[model samples]
Target: MKKIKLSFDKFKDSTIYLNSSKSESNRLLIIKALSEKEITIKNLSKANDSVLLKNLLESENLVVWDAQDAGTSFRFLTSFLAIKKEHVVLSGTERMKQRPVKVLVDALNKIGAEILYLENEGFPPIYVKGKINQVKNKLDIPGDISSQYISSLILIAPLLEKGIEINIEEPFYSRPYVNMTLNLMNSFGIKSAVKGNKISIKNQEFSSGSYIVESDWSAASYWYSILSISDNINNLTLQGLKKKSNQGDSVISELMKSFGVNTQYKEDGIVLTKIKLDTEEIELDFRDCPDLAQTILVVAAYHKIKLKVSGVESLKIKETDRLVAMKNELKKIGCDFYEEGNYWILEKRRREIDDELSIDTYKDHRMAMAFAPLASKKSMIINDPDVVVKSYPTYWEDLKKVGFIIT
Candidate 1:
């Protein structure tokens, strides 16, 4: 669908079955590949990225792998290919080609894998010549780049001759994602440890096991946005979420509390109930859970909450330049968002809501999903609404369960 219009005054408490996490799913898929016959994955994500990775991993006799717009797939596949010693080219969609993969490539080359960029020097569309006769394992890398780069290297460390040790520089945000990777590897019988900024993994074989991916907290953030600003007090049961999750975005449960949404953890999932809000300002750091920046910004703007957030500069290299996209879009709704010093601040305006609000998705799934919740406060049109298929395929339908009107 090119666009969808959303509106709802109120709806009954309902259950929404969240899909499994694409982050965990993609990692487990790599772990499975390493184990070969020793592992099985349950509830793998249906996100386009995970689906493409699954299909490509299962395909045989293929020399060229096209990862499309799936950035995670390309990075993970790059490492996977290097370890398998496969001599082939890994390419992706136009936008994915633009995303930088050189950090991982350089680290891989240092450890004896030959990877060369076929297009731009620091980006994708690369030729992989597999593992070579060289010996190197310790790498010192900057922590500010994508966490996926750190995780990509960690995932392949166990197969190398000397294993690997990574020392991440300070000013590191998004540490939770890297932790999730190590935790997942541990579950598969791999031994790892982190001392200060140094992450060390010893060479070992993956043991036989099964991994169940939890419900995506990133996907659940949209629901948190929905409940936070909806016209009335509505309760939503987010199925499959847990009180304790390794996923960093699970912080949404606590963050939404600032907006007066209480989370009650249940055996089957999480239930969200809204209460009265009296807060005017919130200061947060998105460094660890950058994905929630857009979703939380929407609530802050709607409530006229003064928001001071940091660690979101990384959003520039995401599906789009989210910082610029958000700045441009929030203006339409009368909120002024700009960076002051180290913090990006959102100042709410005292104004009448336009009869209808129109939101552009910028081809970024989070942008579309984050603003759709505004319908609970005002009817809005979401251009490119289907971009949500990147992570949450049933997002609109799930919103419908909570009485959101989409046309």
Candidate 2:
């Protein structure tokens, strides 16, 4: 196992070039495929997700796409293939196989796709028999499930002979994700509408177009965490983030205000400055933005702040059981993460940092990257550092740009 040990006494000011958003890049790849027109995308994500999307689009005949733990690839391609009606076996890493795809499979079945669960129900390695004609326009898909399923269907909606209308049952989670899909669709000359838990897209061919991917807002949250705990915030300038971003994790700008990070909008990106504020206990429903859970939890624990979090049931199905990972690791740093009915509370009982904070990444990229920012407070080692290739391939390099020494 390859491990990267990060030492941080204090970091100096330096300019960092962050990777572009894999989410946007993948969505655009599907759009371009539908458009069947050649276009140039600038600053595309170098992460594995974008790489898989690019490769799969170019490959033909008996393709075994090693998604390498890219969830977006597993899902977006699943729907993309259903539209093209190509016979392919979609599989990923062992951990990816464990991630449930039953929701998407069932939805695709309703739309007339021949899909069989290869190994087990609700898991990967599904044999998809693609190319079924006559996908109905109106359908009921669960809203509380992974938004990837919804995004998958929406990406192909415009191509269907009958435009698709999705009726979302129950309160939707990851709403920002659905909105991000719509925003990207619009950029590619397609539009969608949401009215009372229903999203409708009219039948229209996607236009071939070039798209510029913004820096990942999810990646920026780590810097927000470091700035929240660091004494000097004047040095951190996160570039390529937009004030108006489709990424839902941009809520970090508003949520981190309570943690003492003042946000400033710039033409290039946003600047985070430390401010004077009395930290207090807070509560939020993260159902709309589950990806932000780890960054917020680490920031809360490192600051010794009390926090109540909800809408985290999806954490169990992510790259790792994030709730369990956080609970176990936070205990090493003298913090207690416990569940109370529908809420999980982070109680900071002590200020003592473990002399050498050792972390297990559990093959989850976020686990390694999210916790690494805490090293700004103390020295730490992250196991399985390469796991970050799932999203931010340059994560460790970007940290080094900010004066973090990795050995």
- Write down the lDDT of every candidate, Cα atoms only: 0.88, 0.83
Give lDDT tens digits, candidate 2, residues 343-378. Answer: 999997486887568999888889998889778767
Best by lDDT: 1
Model 1, 1-407: lDDT tens digits are 48888898467657889989999999999889877556989999999889989999888878999998888888898888998846799998788877888888898898888889888998989998766444888999889878898999999888887999999998887999999999999998889989999999988888888888899999999888887887574788889988889899999998888997989999989989997788898799999999999999988888889999999978988888899999999999899999899999999766756767888988899999888888887888999888888889988888887787888
RMSD of 1: 1.4
Maximum-TM-score candidate: 1
TM-score of 2: 0.96
The superposed Cα distance between candidate 2 and the true structure at residue 65, in angstroms, equals 3.2
